[model samples]
Target: MLAVLEKVSFLLKMKVAQGFQTQIAGFYIYLGLMPSWSTRGL
Candidate 1:
């Protein structure tokens, strides 16, 4: 039971990390694709 709980927590952490990475990557991609637009908006 403890092991299963640990595994679930670990998977959740991994998913959160993956989500953060993807969001950061998407932000970079957006900047790369439209630097001027981003700059202007910012």
Candidate 2:
């Protein structure tokens, strides 16, 4: 029973980490796009 609980918690942590990484990647992509957008505006 305890082992199962531990596994579940580990899975939850992994999911959270994955979500956090995806957000970070998206943020970086947005940052990468911003410079081109600004230059085009000028």
Candidate 3:
């Protein structure tokens, strides 16, 4: 699963490098989908 996230992040980075404006959008979406918030002790 972590590998998958890394792959997705890499792809997103590639798109951003190509001048896509969705970089931060994709990052926030990724953050929202990540499970760390539920598992971590705040």
- Please write out the lDDT profile of model 1 over residues 1-42, one tens digit for every residue: 999999999999999999999999998888888868667888
Error of 2 at 40 (Å): 15
Which candidate has the top score in TM-score? 2
- Each candidate structure's TM-score, on Cα atoms with residue i matched to residue i, is 0.77, 0.82, 0.44
lDDT of 2 at 38: 82
lDDT string, candidate 3, 1-42, tens digits: 999999999999887776655777787787778799664653
For candidate 1, what's the RMSD?
1.8
Among the numbered candidates, top lDDT falls to: 1
| Candidate structures ordered by lDDT, highest first | 1, 2, 3
lDDT of 3 at 26: 87
- Clashing pairs for predicted structure model 1, backbone only: none
Could you tell which candidate, 2 or 3, scores higher by TM-score?
2
- In candidate 3, stretches whose alpha carbon ends up further than 4 angstroms from where it belongs are 20-42
- Residue 14 CA displacement from its true place in model 3, Å: 0.2
Local lDDT at 5 for model 1: 100
